[model samples]
Target: MILLLLTVVPVAAFTPWARNDSAAYVFRDHVTGVLEKRRRKLDALRRKGGDAIIRDAVGRGLHWNALGVAFPRDARDDAFEKFAQTVVAHQPVDRAMLRHDTLAGRRLTAADHDAMRSERRRLATVDADQIGATGDDARNSRRRLAAHDAGRLDATGAAIIDDWGLSFENVTRISLKAHAALGREARKQNLTAGVVEATLLPGDVAAWLASPRLRAALDAYLGAKAYVRTRIGALRLTNRLTAPYSGAEPNLLGYPSGFWHHDRCGRRVKAFLFLHDVKADGRPTLIAEASHRTHYYEYKDLLQSRFSDEYISSNYDVVQLVGPRGGGFLFDTNTIHKGRSDGKRGRTVIIADFMDTRKLYTFKKLRYRGPCGQHRTVKMGGEDIACQSWCRR
Candidate 1:
């Protein structure tokens, strides 16, 4: 009976879930939500800190805790084989589009060539410690951060990131010239530049990624040594120009609001630099305070349905992140949050993610063109020797 339950469970659960890829996403997210709750509960009981407790519970050799939970090895293997077989049986061959072809009319420009060249030079000669603080400086920053975290001072990097898993740094502003340039570029590429995972033009990347202010803040946030293991991913923009959008969609919180979702299953931090002044009407990102540490039921419900006023009142200490142009926030992606526009005009932000080798969920190979037009590649997530070389360099 035990063996039968193990054999039948995965089939019963995942079969329907797999039929609709959309449903599969929902199911997977729901499972991770439950797991996150369980892990936190277990952590409290064990009195462990800093991912140590959950790591112990989930680690089986090098594999994570999710690998073999609902299925026995043989059963899971059989299920995957059957799924692959069914896919192969149904999939059709189409040779008209070559895999190596770039997107139509997306040819690289002179600025792209320049940016590529600059990026390669930076990567090849970049020193981690060049951006890192000395030991004494880090210690001093930590002391100041601790005070700020305790509310003895204004909110700073230490207070938000160390305790709240968020940072609203009142850092240096993005210059008016740079902001206008970004806006102009957005207008030129209105069709593609502002969406999620949109490949940034070389000029945009060169401007934002090369910001000395951003680098300095990141250095302070990651500490001296921790900053060394970091890699930048997805330096894209969030453009919400078509405002007065509704967040009333039934399927996947269909609306122009920030839906509650974690960025990844594992630990990751993302940053958003507002290129212009952001107000409530601009559809600023709403974060549930400390939702990273505590599981809120409203988050679960909101995922399946629409956001309720009652739900917001009862469940969340919602933090509407409103700030001026050049100001920004950095936050742990594990927190449940949403962003939506409500005004007539759209708001634009420079969005970027900083991934540490320490925590990850999905893995993707990152490729870049070198200064000499040579191909360079590194994996974004998961453990890889090549990533170590790349990050360290």
Candidate 2:
């Protein structure tokens, strides 16, 4: 009886989504068939003696399929046998003719029989309904998943819609959430310490740099080594700008000449010039402060001091600029900044940087002097002269 209760109750509960699906239905049917066959065997045992019944039941249960198949065979043989044994052993029956007598008592009451029949019928109905519903759901899910895989939905859009369908509220909520997440990541990358840096709206400065005349000028200045290209819908020029002299290979460090730097003497030196006007006012040239002093020998000490890998030392002051679209300059390797052409319309400018190759001439007897000329000397055939013109005190 207990074994029957376990088998019937679970099968009834599984009639909905579980039995409706193809895989689940196959498993369910196989298990149910096996249980019914066992039930008949148990009933026959009850007609015989109790000891005979136990022996017969155990023999039948032990001969279960051993191929270890899933669903029908595995589920029934393994699960049902153990369950039946536990139930049969607990029955209050003596060894003599108990099986036959108990079998008579085991017949279900009218209400119980009717209830079981009704439950079985209800399960069949639910399983049929679920089969149709699940098929439709799977088809729709596949279509949507394919569309997403084909790039019809971008990374941000796909993530949002996949979890929540095409609802306006969901889209908007997801977009805002994505923007917030990106902003957080940017802050980490930028190592921003204070207030958030404002980002210009998309296409805000497009008109300013999109003119044919400006493009022509930039092309002429930049030459064939580089050109402008639209990437991710943004108009940007790619070129190797000259960089400060690091006593290394020329192309290895492309320095931006349109920059400024504070020399060891704290004197502001203009490093390069830009050919284009950035629309944004006070748009600064970006600079990363090396934790070490400019001298190469101090680099190891700087690294030891826990200086940030990339530190922002200074930037151009754009506060005085009239508007977002305006010509601006960046100091040399000392300070870092980039041109912003998105601030206004019809604003155009050129960009260029100076390459420092003084290291190549360092061994030519031209003594290295301080920032200002103090003591001067001529080389080779030239006469000795005061270095006042080169070195500063």
Candidate 3:
């Protein structure tokens, strides 16, 4: 572990400035901090039967934390899960609803929400519904079906709608709840990222998950109810470069977050809500408009490293999601995007991901489910999410 830590932590210095650093001392400090954080996480993941889950995860080269192993879930989670499964959409949303919702009193926006237009597929088309990536499962989505989902954009209903200008009585309350709950995570570890779920979510945020807007959008987009796929969504924090390395990287020690890449999450739309003001320097996410529809799951060979920003910009309209606190956008992460978080500043962003419950739930029952130490495991990005149809290993 020490050798591995030494190799990765110091190498980051060559990439970009993360907070401040005096290579003479900060390197060792970063090593200590990172190891300590991993030890803490390992302790938590190894608790109860969590080790079994960890073994299952590591054996498959997966991230153990996202399994949500051993994390306590109460009655509220059960209720929310049920709500997610039952809610029906009055009307289906369009291919890409680029609108912002309210969070922390801020509104998010996707400049051209309708830009993700495709004649062959709808925003909700699952991987199985279309051609799949290579070396995937046997099907690999070889059969291409023309989504056949024709719709007149429903002003009220959208496949990907966020809570930007739309304010409910609980928006502020939910924001505060998220801060209080997620802030502790940030302060405790100067966290880089975490998958928020279950008890980690405050009451208001959990209730908001069941809100008409989220539910309707999810239901319409999926053409069925959404389900909780272990990771409820992202409850990630990015600390300013003041620390040794930008922040605690407990999730994926060196997950490439800066490059413009697709989330590899297929046929999915995630709602992002910024906890504080996010700007170009604060690691705000920069997205390529219309790429969501244009790229359409061709994520295997995507990223700014290979496909330069200049090239992508030439083909697609790049939209930087810079907004104040509470500002965020519900984007089809399948599009090209990047978060610029080199520690110039830091911010906390929570993402609410609504996955297709119909296919997800149908496959697995209570068979392999359990607390952390003994939870079910899948490859990273989850093989179950839209059939693991995206481009990462």
* lDDT (tens digit, per residue) of candidate 3 on 263-300: 53333556666656777777566676645432121122
Tell me the tens digit of each residue's lDDT in model 2 across 257-356: 2222222211111211122333333232333322111211011111111111112222112221221222222222212223322222322222222112
User: In candidate 1, what are the lDDT values of residues 147-198, reduced to their tens digit?
Assistant: 3433311121112232221123322233333455555655776645233322
List runs of model 2 lying over 4 Å from the truth. Answer: 1-276, 280-284, 288-293, 296-327, 336-358, 363-393
TM-score of 2: 0.17
Q: Which window of 10 residues has the lowest lDDT sum in candidate 1? A: 94-103
Q: TM-score of every model?
A: 0.42, 0.17, 0.42
